[model samples]
Target chain A: MKKYIWDGIFKNNPVLVLMIGLCPTVAVSTTVQNALGMGVAVLFVLTMSNLTISLLRPMVPESIRIPIFIIVISTFVTITDYVMHAYAPAIHKNLGIFVPLIVVNCIILGRAEAFASKHTPLPAILDGIGSGIGFTLAILGMAIIRELLGSGKLAGHIVLGTKFAATPILFFSLPPGAFLAIAVLIALTRLRK
Target chain B: MIRMIRSLVLVCVVAAGLLSWVYLFTKDRIEEDTRQKVRANLVELLGDTTLTFKPVIPDTLWEFYRDTTKLGIIFRSYGKGYGGPIPVLVALSMDTTILAIRPATPAEGLKETPGLGTKVTEPDFTNQFKNKKPSQIKLKKDGGEIDAITGATISSRGVVEAVQVGIAKYLKYLR
Candidate 1:
């Protein structure tokens, strides 16, 4: 249980470790709000897909299983795309194709292939929720740092007073900023280990 | 033999059942979502409270919005941006006077540079394009009109140029 739940949080965090789904990670993380929106979206899709895969595990033929998992994930993504478009156009616009791209997030597919097929429904769902939360926390952490340094304003609101927000460090908002931030955080994490 | 056929039929039925379940759940929403997106994009680029917009026009081309009497302006603005193309829709008052400019997609290549290129979507930048004539739309470099962004010359210039070309095309057709 611990391995299943804790692995995603840090030991095998998707963004921090495996580093799949970097596109959405960077794009939707412009603000803390967008990051939360995307994090929730990922959490929902990952959990639902995991649960469904586990429930259907017994009968799925091994050879054709990848296709089955994909279909299940895509269906959830479409639902999210539609729902977000209708209710949350801002987040919808922000997320863009990266939302559809979730159908291929290595974490979701990895869980399906690695755990869901062999696990029971409850454990699979728990594992999904746990890992999804881990992913959410990881992305949120990245967003906080990026928003702080890049925009000098977290979530579009003026943080650190208006003065600093107006003249944020130039490089933090660039591509190199993202790479540098990710590198430092990972390196810091390793030192802690 | 009868039992084997029944089992095979059962598996096929299950597979079909799952497929239909997902399809039924996702179909209408996807279409509705697209409709909403196009509408929002039109609004963002066009900014007319009265006109209704449609996405039937070619990509980065016209956004169709019609008032009660007849069809309204065709949006025609886009720029070669830092990462990619920044497309916009310009509305007119039928006499070729400006009506609105709704910015659509920001350049696609700016994912890594959101702090910079993403600013292209800002109202401050988009607002400058509104109410200006094609002749008055060039960047400060050409000595015609708009101000280039302080740090992001490429993005600033792209928006100005897109409006310049788009207005020229739209005005010709409107006349």
Candidate 2:
């Protein structure tokens, strides 16, 4: 059980190692709050989808499993989107289309096909949580770096102090900055091995 | 094949049923949230909570009143932004000078590049429009009084032009 969770956070780290679902990771990592919001949303969807798919494995025909997985995933995504919009309007607005775009996130679909379809509900859920954590940690790390350097702030507060001389690197706040940060992260993870 | 189709249909039926349930649960709250957001933005733009707004063009334009006295008018405008059209709400006093301005919330389709183009929605940018005549709406580069946001020239220009065009089209309704 521990191994299942460990593999996702370290061994099969979704963003750094597996390199899936990079779209939202890069797009929403511009702010720490956005990164956290996306992370929680992905975690909920991933866990629920994995559990549902695993339970339905016995009944779902192999020929149409892909469509079934999609239906399940999109249903969860829409629910998350609605709930976020209703309750957390600020985060929902910041997340924008990315919330609905969660339906296309390959991590959820990839897990459904490669792991959940074969595993039992318990293992499937563990795997979901593991991968979700891996994704959250990777994106959160990137957000901290980008937000701090790009805006000279942490989670929207100016932490660097007024005496700091150098101007915030605007490049770190742009798309190119996301690529550079992710590349450095990938390189660092590789170096650890 | 029949079995495959049967299972697919069954899965879809179940999924649809579940989605409808969730939608029904969230529908009223979502609409209420939207109405509240609009009200908040209206209050912020008009600078008064006590004012009541009535639609002159039904969502396109509205007139704000304070106890039967017409205070000003607010209208919606769109600009061709970096990602797509940016909708702005501009409030004008009875004499037609700008009262205040606001961009659409992200939920209302204000899709601009984050950190750069998105700055147009911030007060530092929107506030520049306040108390200015329509002739002063253009950016400094275009020989107008308003200063454009750094590194966000396109988006800044988009809002400036949107307000310019919106006022041109809607000014007659106020008169």
Each candidate's fnat: 0.09, 0.76
DockQ values of all predictions:
0.19, 0.67
Q: Compared to the true structure, candidate 2 yields what TM-score? A: 0.82
Q: Give the worst 10-residue stretch by lDDT in candidate 1 chain A.
A: A21-30
Model 2 clash tally, residue pairs? 0
- Candidate 2 Cα deviation (angstroms), residue B86: 4.9
Error of 2 at B54 (Å): 3.5
Error of 1 at B54 (Å): 9.5
Candidates in order have lDDT scores of 0.71, 0.91
Once model 2 is optimally superposed onto the true structure by TM-score, how far is the C-alpha of residue A12 displaced, in angstroms? 0.8
Clashes of each: 5, 0
Clashing pairs in model 1?
A: B44-B102, B45-B101, B45-B102, B45-B103, B46-B102
TM-score of chain B of 1: 0.67
B1-175, model 2: which lDDT tens digit per residue?
Answer: 8888888898889888988898899888898888787778789887788999887886689888999998788999998888888899999998989999998866577898888999998898888888999998888999999888899898898899889889999888776
Kindly list the per-residue Cα lDDT of model 2 for residues A157-193, writing each as its tens digit: 8898754415888899999999999999999999999
TM-score, candidate 1, is 0.69
Where does model 2 exceed 4 Å of error?
B55-58, B79-86, B94-175
- TM-score for each model: 0.69, 0.82
